[model samples]
Target: MRILVILRRVLDPAGIVAHRRLRRLFINREEYLIQPGDHSALEAALRIKDLGGAEVVVVSGQPEPDDDTVCRGLAMGADGAIYLSGEGFAGADDGVAARLLQAVVDRLGGADLVLVGMTTLDTAQAQLGPRLAGALGWPQIVGAWSVEIVDGRVRAVRRDGDDYVVVETDLPAVVTVPGRALEPRYPDGARLVNVYRGEGGMGEAVLRWDVADLLHPEGLVPLLENRGRDFPPERELGVRVEGTTEEVAQAVAEALRARLRGA
Candidate 1:
């Protein structure tokens, strides 16, 4: 079985500060980490590979020259990794990414299962998995808490309202794991060292493909546009009301009613 996992890099939230009043974001330190949700997806893929006979492959979720994300996956026990790079792909949007990933799957001769993050941390956009599924015309199970393969099908648990529900899909399906659903194991020390230093065939396992080879000019055009940023109104100081218990309660009710009316 061939399992494909998509990985993305995100700026660590702890290294940045959001200035709401200034409507500007400040970065004290620029540090990148694997997207949390995607990390869980990788863990799910590794677990499946450990139990059943499967080859795990990692692919870049975006266009980046750096292969850090894929190399990290290799250290975590992935069989192979593919890096999608080139100038044309620099600012590609989700639609373009989905199309590119579909092409990669085809180039890989298809896969038995595909895994991706339910959402990205910075953008909080849960569109990649569904978009890729749509592009491939495959069944998708999103926001999975846990996943396993049984009877030639992929079984996953997802939260439905207040309870967890089991959902199953046939093989060759897409699954998006939720963030922090499963703890990701630490990478092997030797493998981690080799992958980062490009030694011991680890560097050879990570293949790079030019975006131009997979997409045309029309396909490279982004479907979304950034128009600028918007900031919320500044917070105001609280008002004080003095009176007995009943009087205070009545004052609060009246204040709420007035605010509602104004809204």
Candidate 2:
């Protein structure tokens, strides 16, 4: 069995500072880490592999220097990795990525299962897995807490309202793991060194595939464009009501009525 995992990088939030008064963001430090959700997804794939000898391959569309996420996956235990890059793919949104990754799955000769993060940290976009599932015409399970495969079928634990339920789907399905679903294991130190140094048979573990070769450049155009960040206006101080309980309640009701009238 072959399992495909999607991984990506996100900016470390600790390094950024937002100034509401200035209406701007300041970068005191520039740092990146594997997306938390994706990290857990990788761990889920590794656990599956450990249970039943499945080949785990990780794929990423992050640009050249951002291949760190895929490398980290390899160090953590992925059997292979694919890095998708090109000028046209630099700014791909979820829609464009779904199409591009669809072509990637085709080129990979298809997979028995696909795993990815339920949402992104920076953008909070939870559309990639479902979009890819739609592109592939496969069943999809979102926000999975735990996953396992048996008898050519996949089973996962998902939240339904206030309860967690076990759901099962056939092979060749897409599963999106939540960020905190599982505790991600640390990368093997020796394997990480070998991967970065391109030694110990780790050099050939990663393959670089240009997006231009997989699909026409026209298809790489993003459907969404980022105009810029827009911060909300600074908040005004609240008026304090000083009186008895009934008076304060009346004051609150009046304030609500005024706000509702404005609305």
Candidate 3:
């Protein structure tokens, strides 16, 4: 079976967002951190690769598909990488982005399953995953925590509201993996460092995709815009002390009861 994993560039979530103080900075925004969903997708995709039965392919959005990026994906365990890069598609928003990605799928067209991160690092709206699936007319199992391939069918575990979910689907399906669903193996440094130096290396690895390549009109729709933001001052925290173990328990119970009564 062939599995295609869609990797994306994301801002690290642990980092704090900074105020855009420099006008010349490249794409600076107040929300500078990558969302958690992107990490989840990468981790999940990597897990599928490590399991060993399928050939894993990685795809990304860039103006030109880079050999270095492909090497990195290989280091992370992908068999190969596909970059859907170009000029007109550079500023495409999520909807437009989906159109571009769908074209990549059509162009690269041979896969039993396609896995994507739940959301991109920059945009946490979690829109692209499902949209891409819809555009491709594929069955999608969103927010899967775990997936197993058996006899060309997929058995996936997912989150459903407060409950968990498990579903079985046939091949040629698109599944959006949830955040940190599984651990992504560390890059194989020794092997990756040598992939480029090795014989017959990404000989001429590059794909130049233009918006005109797609069946859709070359229209760029803005996925997001900042109308405004509200800054709420941090609320002051307070602490209360209860006399003894018994007294503290009593106080907590009384407070809870009183709050519930009011509600």
Candidate 4:
């Protein structure tokens, strides 16, 4: 089974605060700590490989030297990685990224399973996985913690609060994993050296279809919800006490009554 994961280079908090006033949410130029969501997705894919999946591939947004997520993805355990770059791809919303990723998948011969994080930290738009599934026309299940690739079929365990589920799907499907899937593993030191030592890295590097023109904001039209809501209202509390067990209840009621009267 071939698996694909989309990784993003996130801005460090200090970098964000430094330029937040400019309204630039990201500074992709600097080194990045892998987004936990991205790590979770990769971790799940690794587990699938460890359990016998044929291959694991990572797809990242950009290939700049500072893009730690893509480089580390190979170090961590992915068999290969693909990077996409183009003018109109900048500032792509979740749906747009999903669209772009679908294009990448088509060129990569599609995947047996696609893994994505539950939600992107910067955007908090937990919609990418489903959107990608929509674009790829695959059946998808969200928040999976464990996945098994069996004879070209997928059996995944998804958590719904305290309970969990086991679902089955054919190959060429999409799946979004939550942190519950598995913990990240230490870099495969020896394998890392061996893989990078080869020329042009693992797997073929393909540019895929460029969808910038089709994905421009205006081309899709718009119906954005109002952003930046006010914080929820605060609640105040008061305490009361009274005498004997039975009479105490009455006394507490009287005290509450008096307090309400005072108010």
| Cα lDDT tens digits for candidate 4, 130-246 | 998998899998777777777788888877678887888987888887754578898877756654554344424322334553355553333343475243334446555656888
Residue lDDT tens for model 2, 61-156:
665657677788999999999999887878899999899889989999999899999999999999999999999999999999999997889999
Which candidate model has the greater TM-score, 1 or 4? 1
Candidate number that wins on lDDT, 1 or 2: 2
What are the Cα lDDT values of the candidates?
0.91, 0.91, 0.65, 0.70
lDDT of 3 by residue, 127-231 (tens): 777887788888888888888776778788988789998898887888887666765656776666656664344433334346566645545555666665444
Q: Name the lDDT value of residue 149 in candidate 2.
A: 97
Worst 10 residues of 3 by lDDT: 25-34
**Model 4 clashing-pair count:** 0
What is the alpha-carbon lDDT of model 2 when measured against the actual structure? 0.91
Superposed Cα deviation of residue 67, candidate 1 (Å): 2.1
Top candidate on lDDT is: 2
lDDT of 1 by residue, 1-263 (tens): 99999998999999997777888889999988999999999999999988987899999845555777888899999999999888778778889999999999999889999999999999999999999999999999999999999999999999899999999999899999988899988999999999999899988998888888898878989999888877676677888899999999999999999999999
What C-alpha root-mean-square deviation, in Å, does candidate 2 show against the real structure? 3.6
Stretches off by above 4 angstroms in model 1 are 61-64, 241-263
Scored against the true structure, residue 215 in model 1 reaches a CA lDDT of: 82
C-alpha lDDT of residue 125 in model 3: 65
Error of 3 at 161 (Å): 4.1
